[model samples]
Target: TGDLLPPLVHLGAAAPSGLVRIPNSNPGTPETLLATSFNMHQVTRHKLTLAGASFRVATTPLLTCDDVDFHPTDILVDADGSLLVLDTGGWYKLCCPTSHLWKPDILGGIYRISRKGAPLIEDPRGQELAWRHVPVEELLRRLADPRPAVRHRAADQLVSQSQRTEEWLDDNFATRPPAVRLQLVWILTRVGSDNAVTCLRSLLEDDEPEIVTAALKGLSLLRDRGCLEAARKLLQHPDGAVRRNAAELCGRTADRSAIPDLLAALTRTSDRWEQHALTYALIEIADVSALKQNLTHQSASVRASVAWALQSVAPDQLQAETVLPWLTSETPLLQQTAQLLTAQRQDWETPLADWLQRQLAGGGSVSSSLLAVVQHFGQSEHVQRVVLAAAASDTLAASARAALIRGLGKSGRHPIPQDLTDTVVSLLETSHPELLQALLDWLRASERSAAFNRRIWPKLLAIAQDDHYSATIRLQALALGGEERPVLPKPLFEFVLEHLDAEQSVPEQLAAVAALREGTVSPLQRR
Candidate 1:
């Protein structure tokens, strides 16, 4: 057993467990010794240690326990002098007790440690073969190697010599096993040559679903128009995954011609996830005629998809006859979709405002959906009604009120109505931080208007000087006050200077500086 208390060992102690000597063929080179240190959690090599440990030939470990818990059990020196280390992945204690115990078939691994830059003495497993000079046949054979590292190395070598490798794969693709064929398709994509598209297309007709899917993925990477056509045919493939993959490939290629195929898939597919994929693909292609045709489809999902997709399409082309019907659709998704589309058009502003006013006057429960229309299209007259409703409605959500406040700020460039100004000033006493912040933002945006500055500035100055409010609200109030030129009393100026020298946070100090700069003296004069 290796030493257990490695934490107390002197720094750089080998704590060597499985030590093996590598025979040197050339006497001129120093003798090489390989050992695993359980304490250091790595396999290291050294030159012949006679008294103390031999001077380190290399400081970096030959192999590190980066992934697995490598409690190396034993080390073997092959007849050819290559090193093999047996790692007993001590992961049982690391897993939950209720989980399945470690299976040796999956957990056991053998790591090969071979010296590079020099040939191994009489190696038989082709260990000494240079990757660049390796025959295409030899590299292809290595694709089926039991170890992933070997397979990856073989693939990398094949990719480097891609022209020759592509020719070889095209010549013998049918004779290879399905497993090997899959690997070939993967490597061809990495080769990224004109030949890859041709090869990937042939595999699209393979009997296996996995092979077809792999081919589709490979073709998507090429982004050729021919690949887009191939993917279009797979939209109706029997396998759902194949269809989904095809839809995604069409989206990535962005071929507008695929819109009809995507819409056809959207009609027949009941799967929610598949429908989402097709919808996203349609959105990316954005063919206005194709999307408009799907608006009246019986599936609420399809109608909703059309609604979402239309947001990106130019608004000028959307006729009222095509868009207005979806606004009254029973489905919430369609209703929201219609609202967003309606909000983007300036011509629809009057009609949308009229609808909002009717809903409010009828004492209807103003849905956030309805409020959104007002927020986007409302002007001065509309803002007066919404502000009054918001101030009067106790059942209104804070978020809805905040949205309305923001909408009022954006309503018009002219002076705000006195009633709306009074309503906003009254909200400063509100306890809800979100509502208060929204009110402050609105006040700041409207501060340039003389009427707004005269009405709101005094209320802001009082809130900033009040110590009972939290520092965050006070800072917001101070910032809002700085947006206008309100005459401050001497005590207010002295009050701002006091905070600059006190044990205040940086934000509070910044707010104090802004207040002095606007209310008392100019910042340029102070500098």
Candidate 2:
């Protein structure tokens, strides 16, 4: 035991483990010293030295049980010569693998030791008991105890009183058994809040499948926007399970951008169970084109998956004479499948658009499926019908208006077609702030002749005063006024100056300054 001193000193073992240092207050000199340690016999020793000569004291044996182990974790000695030792449990080595033996009596004991002259004085059991500080390992061992009561007590200590929660997580999160880490992720994420959100996010990329699942489930419980972003990034994860979880999260949020990534995942990954989960999520988000090719898969399950996805994409598009046979069977799955084939008419853009045009003519609102059809058939006559329908409905009006603005703005130096202008202006007159801004943008396009500005000045002035509009729109109006200059209002100059001097955005401010100078300085005069 005494030969252990050199190795112990080399390891700084004599310098108390888990000791807290308090600095001395005297100016220009080092301060008070307090050191504590717990010996292998479960005896705690504390030393306090002030101005150079101080007393040393220790606690008595913390445990009296026979055949007890002597691994202790912490020690502290008080001014009254009372000692405290935290008896941690012991470890055992087997031929196959090392194991642990948790001794409750050693961990539960507290002792007080004293020194009389040179020899030590010890009481196995003292009247006065030092505060018991149990090792966190012991508490965690209790969490794994067969007895429910012991597990509950240890859990309460870990969660409520001890500062060992971090220690528990650090110890277990990296190397513990899969099931243990999984449970820890759940508990930590629930009780940890934002603090735990990061830890769980890290576990999302963990190697173990069950650990990743547990982390994903924990993130679901968090419901944080950052967590959602993390999940979105995981849509590209190499692991199928991570990709599947990301798809599931997108379904829960109904985020549209996730559509493309989920589509890609469904096509590339072959895991049937995960594929099924992704298929279900795709259906919820109204995006099914991803599985379109799988409609002819030899496996019934794969074929069924494709069938459902296709039905969602263009149900009527499949209704044509040749493909309709697929849906003719009478089973519930096949009946729904047939309805989808009829909906398959949606697959071929022109027919679906023509169908949507007829539906519009008959006074029915365009279905979302039909709108999807319109997206594929960019220039069909249904475009004209959709324009007309949007001219009629309030919400559809802006989309109708945006399509027109984009189309005309893209058309360069052609004759100013009256029909295009009339359709645009009519839509623009009733358009929202976005539409008004888009129209002004089209009129001022350097690609188009400065000619359109002469026709649109009145509408431009009307939108400039629209304080409900965005600053970008307002700035655009100022630029249009400066560019056209057919008539410049006093407020236009003041607005430009205000933007030039006060706005922090450099581009807009520079544009405003240039516009203000250009409006005041006539080019003809400079020439």
Query: What local distance difference test score does each model get?
Result: 0.65, 0.50
TM-score of each: 0.47, 0.31
Best by TM-score: 1
Q: List the residue pairs that clash in candidate 1.
A: none
lDDT of 1 by residue, 123-169 (tens): 34446656657798988887776444566678888888877876675
**Index of the highest-lDDT prediction:** 1
Q: Tell me how many clashing residue pairs each candidate has.
A: 0, 20
Give the least accurate 10-residue stretch of model 2, judged by summed lDDT.
1-10
lDDT of 1: 0.65
In terms of TM-score, how similar is model 2 to the real structure?
0.31
